[model samples]
Structure formats: C-alpha cells, structure tokens
Target: MEGPPVKIVALAIQGFVGQVLLDAGGNAKVNKQQFLHQVCKRIHSIGKNLFFEFKEKSFKLHFLMYGSYRVNEEKSR
Candidate 1:
C-alpha cells in the first residue's frame, strides 16, 4: 500500500476553438464557473476521481489558474 499510486491531473482547454474566433479584447477567455461545472458533470459520470462511488465515497476535484488541472488523492479511511 506504499506504492506511488499516481493520480493524473489533466487540463483541457475548453473552447479553445471558440476562443480563436472571439476577438480577444477580453471575452476570449473561458468561463471559469461554466468550465468547472462542465468538467465536474463529466467527471461525475465516472464519479469524482473516476471511482464512480456515488454512495460510498464523496469524490471532488478542482481547476487551477489559467486553465490548469490539479488532481490529488489521499488514503481513504
């Protein structure tokens, strides 16, 4: 149980295409809340941490600055 047990934090630049079309100015950036909601919902399908344990364990994830991802896992009690 002391293995690395690696967890991947992947970041997908949502709307990278749309961003190109929208004249920067200030509206090219993605919507943080919207993107977070989308990522959360998608992850929920597989359950947070991709564990899919809806009733047993509560899985949660967060998005970092500038469209970055941060995945963290700890020993489950």
Candidate 2:
C-alpha cells in the first residue's frame, strides 16, 4: 500500500493584516492563549472564521474562510 506523500503548500495572497508580526516582536509578552484571543478578536471584528491549532512549538491561525463566520462566546454548560 502506498502511503500519502508529505506535502506543504504556502499561499502568497495579498491583504494579510499584521503580516509584520510573522517576523518578530509584540507577541513575546503574551501567552499562547492570549495571542489566540487577540487574533480571534480581530477576526471577529472583521467577521471572519478564526481557524486555529496548536502544535509543540507554536499556534497556527487561519482566517481565510469569511462566509460562514461564527463567534461562540457563551459559557459552556
């Protein structure tokens, strides 16, 4: 059986806000959760889906999906 080959695709799209942050600084003081929160806030303000996942080293956030946006701030029961 042939297994799935590893692949990585980077999109070079325009209009990415806070692109400079990808280089360095401003986020060192904040924790992972804090950074995620801030990003989520910004995405919500712009009405977009805040897709995120955390790995061993960093948190990955994607805000490309704009149509089916939803912000869940309600406390879980």
Candidate 3:
C-alpha cells in the first residue's frame, strides 16, 4: 500500500505514544491497553505533523498543505 489507511495511522500513533511513555524513573506508568484507550480519547487534534523515535531511529510525518492524505506517497516523502 502507498499511503496507509486511518487504521495504520491510529496504530502508528498508539505505538509512538507507547514508546514515548516507556519505563521511567517515576511511578506514573500505564500499560498497553490503558495507553491505547487514553490515546484514542483524543477525538480532536490540530496540524498534520507526527513524529516519533524508536531504537536509534526517528520518524517525522507531515501531511502536506492539501490535507492529511497522500496522492503520491513516495513523492511526498
């Protein structure tokens, strides 16, 4: 698939959020299910930018001026 569907977006967001909240020195920690629920509760958001880091790699997704979509996913990169 070129541009992933909304489901993929949701999955990616969930993963990103989970990684961002991984084991910390404090006690405020959440499990996977709770994280997903809390994240999905954000019914609204602004901007077309998303970013995350995993392992030693980083990712940044920008939906462009048109909207949160991609007609040519490769070129968009």
Cα RMSDs of all predictions?
15.6, 13.1, 13.1
Q: Which candidate number would show the highest lDDT if scored against the true structure?
A: 3
TM-score of 1: 0.19
lDDT of 2 by residue, 1-77 (tens): 01111011111112333332222222235454433422211111212223222222334333343221112233346
Give one digit per residue, the lDDT tens place, for model 1 in 10-69.
123222322222111222354333332222222232212322122222333322223323
Model 1 ranges with Cα > 4 A deviation: 1-42, 45-53, 67-77
Clashing pairs in 1: none
* lDDT values for all models: 0.26, 0.26, 0.37
Candidate 1 vs candidate 2: the TM-score winner is 1
TM-score of each: 0.19, 0.17, 0.29
* Per-residue lDDT of 33 in model 2: 46
| Superposition error at 10 for model 2 (Å) | 21
For candidate 2, the per-residue lDDT at 49 reads 22
For this target, which candidate reaches the highest TM-score against the unseen true structure?
Answer: 3
Predicted structure 1: lDDT: 0.26
RMSD of 3: 13.1
User: Cα lDDT of model 2 overall?
Assistant: 0.26
